[model samples]
Target: MSDTIQPPFSILFVDDDQMSRHHFARAVSDDYRVHLAQGADEAMVLLKELGPEIAVLVTDFRMPGRDGGHLLREVAQAYPQIVRILVTAYADKDMLLQTFNTGDLFRIIEKPLRMDSVREVLKQAVARYAERETRQQRLLAMDETLAFLAHELNTPLAAISLFARSVENDVAQEYDPQRQREIGAAATSMLNNAQYCLTLISSFWATVHKSGGQQPASGSGVREVRAARLLATLLDSYPFAGLQREWIDVDVHGDFVVHAMPNCVALVLSSLMSNALRALDGCPAPSLCIEVISEPEPEIRLRDNGPGIAPEVKARLLLDPVTTHAGQGGHGMGMIFCNRIMQSFGGGLRIESTLGEGTTVTMRFPGSRGRIRDADGEQASVTRTV
Candidate 1:
């Protein structure tokens, strides 16, 4: 690891001739860890053992069994992170053209090995190898992250489909009108759950690689969003079928706000509020309250007087891609999608509940400057997140 005596980049040299291997190894041994391969078969074995470390692969164009181009193509497909360099002495013009078509050769070293040219080409190959290695590592990480997200979303989607079919066949035919309604509602909820899962996946993917801040679609000044004003708007848009206003309170001391993508904040707040109201269904004298707490952190807490989340379901509520009370709805993608939206704006979501008491869902928004700026640079007088 010392810079003064840094080892040379590892090089894999494959040729049918023993003398050629010895000469090449002797020439490069001072700097690089040279591996001599008798043929493509031996080269493959060395490659399998020393992947990322084997920086450059020098293969003769014409070998006994498999030709150089064929080997290089295999290397490119199998281990694209390694740099491939082909050496050919008896290449016809047609074969030379074909080499380019076969694999991405770093540099073609015409054989009748000129030591100086080999040194220069090998140096270039090492540099190319470094670049390729970096790119490959990034691609591998991204692929893994995407795969994990896909797997997490699939479980909920499958459950949603199965439960939806059961509700359609069994509950729909029940004689009781109330039972039928509940069954229909359950079906609708399941479909929403699937949509919610898809939204979380799409939002997280977008936010993970987001370059800049969230910008409003219209590059306009941010509209002031007071918690009180925001709550009124939500109530007007979606009148909670049976709303309880006795404990509802909005205490905005200075003006809680956040810079965001215009309608995004509103949509997020409304969704959270709606979810809270729906969660209170069937509870005794169910009451839903919205309180804007300003100290420590600017946030809106939506509490409901309903049978709180069960212990088992509470454990995986927001963590899992799908979450819903069993038998309530076969689909449970709401909270997960809500979490994604909050994360998009440097915000967070919290859930607090007691089995027999009620559930409280808090959405926190980080404070920005006195006047929050939208993506368009316009000042937002008020900010509200439901």
Candidate 2:
């Protein structure tokens, strides 16, 4: 049952007959919150006031002003969430057909209704209401999740744009060894960031399409990803400008490899890099270091020499949206999204920081070091470690 429908669910009984209305309310008052309305006008007033609370509507077919069919149709249009049923003493076949065709009628009870039959019909109506409410809530939740995902991708998209412009600028510069190297690095980084954005977009749309009753093509799942190479790619491609680019170091100690999706890994690293850069805004000797540990568990440690997280903020960092730099336009969904991604890969995210010191974000991939395979069923190795 949906939380919207509390115990002793509400029902609006609308009829012109005072005797019939009172009789029905008295019988069902023990099991439901019965709201008696003399006619369609009174029923409309009650519905306008307590529309969301009322789960079922039982109206007489032949009322004085507006007939039951008209009232049911009005209810269907105004408050479609409510389950509608018509009651009539004159069971005219033509009238019943017209009523069924026009209104959102759930069930029709004849005049002199049996208590047992009414109870069963009400049970079904409540069940139907619950199902519809649950579906509506799920749809609302999905919309919110999609909105959050779009918010999460904004930083990366902006970074990609900046990196692309940098690549163009670096390429147009005078030909020199240093300039050439910088151009090459910038181009590579631009490509990696673009690919990361595409991957996130694809994953998001795939979920949306699946929810909309569309079947997505099956593809390879998690695979052996070289941690050292992945981190290097991320570091090179990250959109860091001016002195910010110089304030970063990469240290790879061992052959770190983990079975995971490359794009997911890229997104997690990108998010961490963005956070580190943002935190290092106004520091004197702002430096960020990424360390890879392969022995105990494949993990990447991102350490930044900047203002650390506050105690209250650190406690619910990944669980909720909390940002120390919200004044600089932070939505606070980056780390939370990263944490969720890590959890999807059978991994976890950990954060440690002191007030005056800095923050260290550890992305732990706890699994055995796996060998990557090529298309020809051959084991491939990444020999580069920085």
Report lDDT per candidate.
0.66, 0.73
TM-score of 2: 0.58
What is the alpha-carbon lDDT of model 2 when measured against the actual structure?
0.73
Clashes of 2: 1
- Model 2 C-alpha lDDT per residue in residues 274-340, reported as the tens digit of each score: 7788789779999999888875556788999888998898989888887764543466777777776
Over the stretch 1-386, how does candidate 1's per-residue lDDT look in tens digits? Answer: 32444343589999998888998988777667888998998899988998767888999988998988889999989988788888888758888788877888878887788887888888888878776654544444344334434544554466587767777578446458877777766676567657656554555545444624333322466465566666666555443332434334444544464443324445556566656666666666767777776665567778777778887777797787455634543356556656655554556577888988988888766555433334354554433222
Q: For all the candidates, what are their Cα RMSDs to the real structure?
A: 12.7, 13.5
Model 2 stretches astray by more than 4 angstroms: 1-9, 175-185, 188-192, 205-386
Q: What is the clash count of model 1? A: 6
Candidate 1, residue 74: how far the Cα is off, in Å: 6.1
Question: What would the TM-scores of all predictions be?
Answer: 0.42, 0.58
